[model samples]
Target chain A: MNGILLAMILALLIPIYEAWQDEDIWQKMLAFASIATKTSIMILVVSVLRDDWMIGLVGVLILSVGNAALMLLAHIIRRLNEA
Target chain B: MLENLDVVAIAALLPLTACMLVTQVDPYHALIIRGILGAVAALVYALFGAADVALTEALVGTMLSITLYAIAVRSSMSLRLGTLATAAPNLDAAVPSALGQQLFPALRQAIKKHHLRLEVLPYASPQALQFALENKEIHAVCVPAEQLATTQGTDDVAAPYLLNVRIPRLYETLAAALPPELVAVSFSRALRLTSAAPPPPDSQLQNALEG
Candidate 1:
């Protein structure tokens, strides 16, 4: 059975896999950034309204870091897709 | 109160609780619902009063949700052999601990009984415990839940009485704290509870076991 952590790991691996597939520095970076950007918006929406500020803050920080990784990947993927 | 869990634990528990919140939805929707719920929580912080945290959450969550959703959407394409209930790894970990689980509660109870504040330290080896004492993370070397068993005529380690706080049997106290589903039938998680008696010269329960 997939425990919660396993599921979460799988969830995280998606953008990483996509960036690897693109083979271009820029496209991969952008795609990676897009994923992060989308997730951050979601987190910001959530955090703006939570009872616990710290929890909301933690979620936001995690998303931001993830997106930054994707931004690096986004450049690669975009280039590969164009070529 | 969900007192047993620390903040990080609660963060994990909250998303899982979505199973109850969206009983009728498909798993994808359930995930979305959870994300949305988290987002809603963030919004509350932003709008109601905690803008600093709201800003912090806003940036990180945007990235995190991307990762989670990307994975979820991709996983849907595969012909997984089992459903989510059976397919996930490490499901057995859901069964919580039995003995050591009470270590915290027992300590707390002892402190409260004496009208004292509560502080907890990590479990460590004797050397590590010594280090912790030097660092002042712990004032005493706490004992395991097991009784202090001893054989005569050997050198028994004299027990130290730092503070007079007697912890009840592990089986007795945490028994109440756990859900009915998690209690194991035999040889629960407390490592010390079932060990052989320490021969006199080596048994530290001779001195430091009592707090």
Candidate 2:
């Protein structure tokens, strides 16, 4: 279980590096989306590994709500470009 | 201790994302990185058996704060430029007028380097435009040299358009970036309280006031 979690953490680093290096706003936003989703999934995996329902529920909430925030941010950025 | 390697790795990501957020130069980019930081923070909190803290971090710290900050940065980081209505008839149109063709693109390009948006507002007369600048309603005013009485009979007459910027930093940016042959950029400290009455254009003043 720990090995799987470590692998997921390694997967997460790919987007973090992308976000840090990319100069384009859209690319950074894509990286943000990747990070947001990956972190919530990691949370879920950890919750399951420990058999903690409370942590699992929080992970589910973040997974759903984080995307909504991402959508709102994307709309704002699109509108910004239009003007 | 080796069994806890995953926890150490996950916890380390929190500081990494925070550093990324702080190092970002652009406000919009920083806001995106802030969202990334919030995500990593929530993950770290959940890993440490603080589910409630994780949820709060995700909901308020990540979602609500980033949305609000994005809106704030978008609206505040723009330069509001007042121009004569007659000079830029098709400013908002797909194909701008000849004057706008010369001005807007160059202005936009210059300010874009600083990550600031250009918002062009039209006024019926130069007085109203100047009034708007003095009132802090706009950051700068761009008018034809012939239209402004104060600019007439000066060396600036060689230039067709005169751009009066109230902020020194904006003046420096425009003066440095814009071609002098295109426009004359000057800085004015007109924001000071003045006893002189505004040029009597009651209707235009009303429009400026409302806008």
Candidate 3:
């Protein structure tokens, strides 16, 4: 368990570094969506381990809905860049 | 199991690393990194047995705020224009400094006409002025009109032809209003110019440069 936690923490740095290196706005948005997905998955994993359905449901909500707003923003930025 | 606790500990550390990384990146990049940081925070909250807080972070911190930042970044651009004013005005003083006497009024008019949120930054010397522009610290440098004709002949100043990024179309407009002696050189072109040769001569930017 301790090892998994360590790996997960280390994994977060990957996206941060990706965002840091890229200048394109779309790529940055994609990195953010990836972060949201990873977080939701982590939450779900923890809830399952703890045998907590309530926590799992919240995780599910984030997993499904969090990216919707980001997609909209990405679209908006794309349109703005086009115009 | 003991293994699960270990996993949670490792998972808990990811967001903290992300939190630090977010600050180091540019504001545009931060917009994206912030979302990931939000998600990592949520997972940490869940690992700590706070599902509710985690969910809120996922929604508010990751989703909502990223959108807000995107909107801000998309609609407007911040410009740092170098100026002669070393400091803010001193109303107590009987006479305004030369920077006040010359630059401010014209800049104020340009800001209103062009709808720019102009910030006047002071540089210690010409080398510092050029360094700041080269490093992308400031958007442009506002030099006295006469300085444009003299310094512009050199390779250093000639590189960009001094076009403003925010108002690419304003070169002609500015030329008319400001004294024929003063000119606003656009520093934003450094990146674009470095990648390619000067733009076509007929281009508006070229017109600004020729003057």
Q: Tell me the spans in candidate 1 whose CA falls farther than 4 Å from its real position.
A: A1-83, B1-25, B80-211
Q: Where is model 2 more than 4 Å wrong at Cα?
A: B87-96, B150-153, B190-211
> Mind giving the per-residue lDDT tens digits that candidate 1 earns over B46-158?
43456566555544453366456545544332211100111224533221132235433444554333223333333323344434444544433343223222331113223
Fnat scores for every prediction: 0.03, 0.93, 0.81
Q: How would you encode candidate 2's per-residue C-alpha lDDT over B119-160 as one tens digit per residue?
A: 888776556766788889999887655555642334855666
DockQ of each: 0.04, 0.88, 0.40
DockQ of candidate 1 (2 decimals): 0.04
Q: How would the candidate models be sorted by lDDT, starting from the highest?
A: 2, 3, 1
| Reference-based lDDT, residue A4, model 2 | 96
* lDDT, candidate 3, A6-76, per-residue tens: 57656756776666677777777777777777777767776776789988999899899888767867776
TM-score of each: 0.21, 0.88, 0.51
Worst 10 residues of 2 chain B by lDDT: B191-200
- The CAPRI-style docking tier of model 1 reads incorrect
Per-residue lDDT of candidate 2, residues A1-83 (tens digit):
88899999999999999999989999999999999999999999988989999999999999998788899999999999998
